[model samples]
Target: MNQLFRLPQVGEADAIAEPSADLRVPFAQSGTFVCKFIIGEPSDQAVCCGAPVADGKSWCAYHRRIVFEPARPGRAR
Candidate 1:
């Protein structure tokens, strides 16, 4: 599979070194933008599949279909 595009952190001078793959996309850090798992919206979902979550995600394991990989194609399947 081809590598997926992702948004890099904003306001970072070093970010210019490796420009973000997608600039139109914006990530939420809390509430609606934040993952439901962390906020306890749904405990049954598996956002990262036992893997450390990123900025926003909702899930732990044996639940939702979100998994994290080094070179993830894109969001979870």
Candidate 2:
């Protein structure tokens, strides 16, 4: 069972490091339209998702879903 969930290989692990291999822009380098989705902890040192935002929104669609939990119709507030 452990084999089914092996730890990441050498190169794979580096992909998720700070300033991700996907070219995640640091908060300093970010433009207004970029997603404000923080990836890690320590808000001051955290990195944003760096994807474009949804229309007139602070975060991208993916991050929007995470940040805003839509209320279920029948659920009590």
Candidate 3:
């Protein structure tokens, strides 16, 4: 039945919005990091925000508008 397979209520949101995939940075040694957005239902998209860091601290980028160093001259991420 549709009810059995239906997904649980996520939250009050119309649709979850995508995150800025382009905003990526270098992760410590050789790895890379980037900011990501956690989409929810259709009513609210700002479910969660975070940036992949080397240390492993997933902060909320939505509430704490992330401010990273501008990409070098030509490089953009």
Candidate 4:
């Protein structure tokens, strides 16, 4: 079989570059947006993700990865 792929080669310049805020998904809903990850039973719910969002992000760093990055092949959500 023919080889079809090669690993990505990131350079120092690429790593040092600042990520553009425009690439992030915008939060359109009113009020403060929090990580949708819930805690406790439905009868007693709470928002314990972290501090209020900074830089106009929708979810925390953890949830942000889940929202943007593509899931690995053969892996369950």
TM-score of each: 0.16, 0.59, 0.22, 0.31
Q: How well is each residue in 1-77 modelled by candidate 1, as lDDT tens digits? A: 45545455222423323212332122232233322333224334422113323544454221233344334445455
RMSD of 3: 17.3
In candidate 2, position 59 carries an lDDT of 77
Question: 15-39, model 3: which lDDT tens digit per residue?
Answer: 4343454443332221333333343
- Candidate 2: minimum summed lDDT over ten consecutive residues — where? 1-10
Number of the predicted model whose lDDT against the real structure is largest: 2
Instruction: Give the per-residue lDDT digits (tens) of candidate 4, residues 1-77.
Output: 34333334322323433233333322232246544433333333333344345666756555555457644444654
Question: How does model 3 fare in lDDT?
Answer: 0.35
- lDDT per model vs. reference: 0.32, 0.61, 0.35, 0.42
From the highest lDDT down, the ranking of the candidates is: 2, 4, 3, 1
Clashes of each: 3, 0, 7, 0
TM-score of model number 4: 0.31
User: What is the C-alpha local distance difference test score of candidate 4?
Assistant: 0.42
